[model samples]
Target: MSVTRTNPALTLGKYVALLAYLLFALFPLYWLVKIAITPDRLIFTEGTDLWPSTTTLDNFRTVIFQTDFMAFFGNSLYVSLGTAAVTTILAAGAGYAFSRFDFGGKKIIVAVMLITQMFPLLMIIAPIYKIVASLGMLNSLTSLIVVYTAFNIPFATFLMQSFFDAIPKDLEEAAMMDGCTRFQALRKVILPLTLPGLGATLGFVFTAAWSELLFALMLISDNESMTFPVGLLTFVSRFSVDWGQMMAAGSLALIPSCLFFIFIQRYLVQGLTSGAVKG
Candidate 1:
């Protein structure tokens, strides 16, 4: 057998490209952390510097102790988790139906879901506001959960359907042949295989719900119910914006999403690698 040799130049080029992409993507995040640590007084004077001469933790101290950032974070967490759970459950059921059964008007139903995604979100904000007000759900976390689930279900359904399609029907059928019920097969065999897909869908929906600003701003006027995105706006005023404190708060806000990804990274990696090999 002959040994294959890889080109060193091509390998070097790939590493260089990856490093460049990483730097580009991470640069903004680095800047956010940098500004968060920089003193407010130096924020303007040394804003463009690669490094600040002095740094302080006062910004973080103020954001955590002096403000209601924690409350806003908790509210955001509740809404995001609720939305992700509800959407994932509904989407999984819907996707399973679409993948396994032939039903009349299925195409029409899918078309409608796609159409909902097509309309500019801004166009429906007014109608959504009116409906929330009429239902007396304004400033309610449950209302945010409901609205977010409704908006996210279509896309999440598609993602689940793709994963289900990747799975072979023969596996489920064989489980049934071996005395397993459909639901039993789903719970034991199918779901285990789809863990990666589930993780991906959950992560996507959680991040979206967490970061949504416009709807949060429109629907929640009560400070107690305000999510992190809306609460961040309080750092701004007509006359001035608190740059250091705002950056500090923003960096702190990133913790949940960061931890979420860290928890799910294994599943995400497995999913991508499996997809690549299977494809």
Candidate 2:
């Protein structure tokens, strides 16, 4: 029997739909870049223009030289990286146990984790604040890191559990048969296979922490301790808004996240579990 190929029209339509969705998603980013490069005088005049009539890098220069953007960027980086690292490690460990073990209270533990995700963050904010205050971590970057890590862990743990489930137990068992201990098998065989999951978890947690504003606003009082999301609020004074500077800072803040995804996107594409199981 001859295998039939997909119809050309259907394939073309699928590509068309994907292209349309991509353009729809990316149009805002295009507009942002357009606004960032446009001269202040032309900003109002060139409203909705695909290309700016005049462009200048002065907005970026002013944001960098005349603002506390670097400090905010550094704070965001520290918090995001710290949250990502801590969350990923905890999630990975929890996920491995969830996937590999059969123990009493496992179902109850998972149900409780799910329940934790059900509550609105507003309900817990007061208690979280009180706890942080009691620990003298209020208004500190460490507070932000702790809060972000805690908030992100449940979801990251679920993500990691899915990844761990996708991996085969036989691989670990085989390693054990070859004289490797459990830890050695996990470190040498399973850990390499879980890199994609780890990368995705790190990226997810980092972006979540980087964009979080509510906890940062509530916990951090010092200007020097502000993350980029809260720092962006500085442009919104009581009377006037600094649109140019805000957009410039927003654009700058996108760089690290972009670079991070670019570095991890390769591993994310690889299906490390392809050979781990028998079909």
Candidate 3:
């Protein structure tokens, strides 16, 4: 009876602690939502209030209808999708080769890939800029897509290799034994089963491409070509910043990323288990 009574108190304490931690961690997002909705006049006045006395949609309205957010959004979407698709395809092929083949210099190739990942991205910024300029692809969205695809491929290949390694080789051999070519087995059998891995890789590469800013800033300068992350910088200048509108745009920016995850949530969790047992 005493233990049972004490258990409730412990559980209550844990809940209180968890609630505190959650509120603390989520405070910035809460503040973002708060400021985005707070009347511009009241933003400074109610700055410390937990809840604003009144809220408005003016900021969101301004960001969506009054700004170049839509164009920036479209550009970002195009680059991110292109990068994700290409990176996933390349990573899938490389991963398959790594998982299924024993080749000369396989370890050396993998070691080089790993080494590329270990270097700071900042170290190669100048060289990349030079290469992009030499190709005359500066200020182009295609350039961003190509750069992002290359940068993401190594890590993504490792991730794909893990997924491929998990599937049983016997499955492929069985298909071959029944008169199917390896390519046919890969397409008709392995491809269908690899949906989760593909989705996970697609989601990862997409998210990385969506959020990338430094490279976008370096490569794209044309107003028409600027991605959303770079456009966010346009919110600032030699003058004061528009905090409310910036936050509003930021809040709106989250929607696509949220949607991407919504589409991948099933595969995201399953990818964990998919990599557990390598056959």
Q: Each prediction's TM-score against the native?
A: 0.86, 0.85, 0.89
The 0-to-1 C-alpha lDDT of every candidate, in the order given, reads 0.87, 0.82, 0.86
- Top TM-score hit: 3
lDDT of 3: 0.86
Which 10-residue window of candidate 3 scores lowest in summed lDDT? Answer: 270-279
lDDT of 1 by residue, 1-279 (tens): 854887899889999999999999999999999999999899889988988999899999998998898899899999999999999999988888878889999999988987877789888899999999999999999999998999998878877887898899999999999999999998888989988788888987898899899998999999899999988886555214688888898899889899787866766655445433432
Model 3: pairs clashing at backbone N, Cα or C within 3 Å: none
lDDT of 2 by residue, 116-227 (tens): 7778887888999899999988879987887888888877787787788889999999999999999899889998999988888898788789889888888887898988
* Model 2 misplaced regions, further than 4 Å: 1-20, 262-279
Model 1, position 169: C-alpha lDDT score: 96
**2 versus 3: better lDDT goes to:** 3
Give the backbone clash total of model 3.
0
Candidates ranked, most accurate by lDDT first: 1, 3, 2
Query: Over 4 Å off in model 1, which ranges?
Result: 1-19, 262-279
The sequence of per-residue lDDT tens digits that candidate 3 reaches over residues 72-137 is: 999999999999999999999999999999999999988888778778998989999999999999
